[model samples]
Target: MNKTILLNNRPNGKPQESDFKFTDSDIPVVNNGEVLLKTKYVSVDPYMRGRMSDAESYIEPFQLNKPINSGIIAEVIESKNDSFTKGDFVSGMLDWKEQQTHNGKDLLKVDADKAPLSAYLGILGMTGLTAYHGLTEIGKPKEGETIVVSGAAGAVGSTVGQIGKILGCRVIGIAGSDEKVDMLKSKYGFDAAINYKTTEDMTKAIADATPKGVDVYYDNVGGTISDAVHANINRFGRIVVCGAISLYNSTSLPTGPRIEPILIKKSVLMQGFIVNNFSDKFPEGMDQLSQWLKAGKLDFSETIVEGFDNIPNAFLDLFEGKNKGKMIVKV
Candidate 1:
């Protein structure tokens, strides 16, 4: 039997285990031009929360009682397609099922010898590309400038901070705990990291951390933390709005301190973008990230949860800050 998960319900706010339904069916058979795939690693990202809702967005919402899909690494156990062979590993947006069949249109072949199969779902995949493109294209950091990252311990945020450091910027990170803060500085090479949960005056904390003023703000968590960063943003600064995990679960519209006045006064440039916006440059970004990884200049972290049944809980753990970097489930 092939195990599968479906969107049991549209989550009201924070997603619970009940929102996902587990079921089993026969393994799909390989037909001409199709390949049978066995899931290897599944990725859980904060952005997926938005897709759980029925509201229209950049991507279509998962239909009620239908399978939920995300980035997945799978092995071609049986192949009928000429482009794929048995034993080949691939990565693509795939449904949450232990086994499935596809025509192999969007799947990209990945080499385990080059990088771990799981890394293809993270540091070498969309997560890494999001960080690379968002920073270089929107944040546009310069040497000697200070770059601040919110959600600094998670997959994209952590990568954003490291990329900022590579660009010669002083990187400051805002995280939920001291442990994550230390990991930011010691593991990812962030210049400074603040535990926002412990800090009382966030604006003051940001101001102190970036004495030279914040030139680029890579925002992953929005809300008060972002407001604080804006308060310390320098003239002609740039803000890359990659995500708003802090506000993803809000039942209603979120209100915060006005940012227009600050933006106008400082001539700041703030832009929100998705990874697909720079799809044309993915090869370039991936090449650079791979080169950095090979040179030992780039490092990645992961909180791997074993078993396919744990995928739902692992996803919920993202909101609770349970993972240090990319969260992956080994199936």
Candidate 2:
């Protein structure tokens, strides 16, 4: 029997464990051009939370009474496709089930010996690509520039900060907790880090870090922290609105410091982007990231929960800021 987590209903505000149900069914048979895969690791990203809602977005929302879809690293158990054979390792979008039979087109065989399989779901996966595109294409950090990134200890945020350091820029990170702030400075090599919870004045904290003002702001948690960053941006600064983790679970729209005046006065460019919009550039991003990972120039972390039943809890952790890096479920 293959166990799966099913969406019981659409979530209201924060998602509860009761919103999901665990079910079991027989392993599916592979069809032509399809492969059977045994789940190894399943990524629980913040974007998945948006999918739980029925609102319109770049991707289709998760339907009520269906298995939630996520990026998964798996081992091939059976293959009806010539492209893949038994015992191959792959990463792609797969159902949150113990075993999955799906079309092979979406699956990409991973070189396990080169990098940890879990990385294919993280640093070598969607999150890493997001950081790369947001930083290079959107933020456009220059040498000696001041770059500020909110949610700096999370998966995408961590990558952004480290990349900023590699580009010879002063990187300032803002996270939810002191420990995350420490990780940003110590492990990720961020020049400065601020814990939003500890700091009463966010704008002051940002100003203190970037005394010359920020050139690029890679925004992950959009709300007050973002507004604070906006308030201190230099002329012609760039803001990449990657993911708004703060507003994802809000029952109401959050109000923050008025930033339009700052934007107009500084001529700051603030743009929102979905990673999928840069699919054509993904291969180049992955290649560059892979080289950096192998050269020990980058670091990444994953807070993994064991068992498929923990999928809902893993997702709930994201909203609470309970996770340090990329949160994944090991099924």
Give one digit per residue, the lDDT tens place, for model 2 in 79-193.
9989999999999888888998878887899988998888998899999999999899999999999999999999999999999999999999999888898899999999999
Off by over 4 Å in 1: none
The most accurate candidate by lDDT is 1
The residue ranges of model 2 lying beyond 4 angstroms of the native Cα positions read none
What is the Å distance of residue 230 in model 1 from its true position? 0.5
When summed lDDT is taken over every stretch of 10 residues in candidate 2, the lowest stretch is: 251-260
By how many angstroms RMSD does model 1 differ from the true structure?
0.6
Error of 2 at 218 (Å): 0.5
241: Cα error in model 1, Å? 0.3
Clashes of each: 0, 0
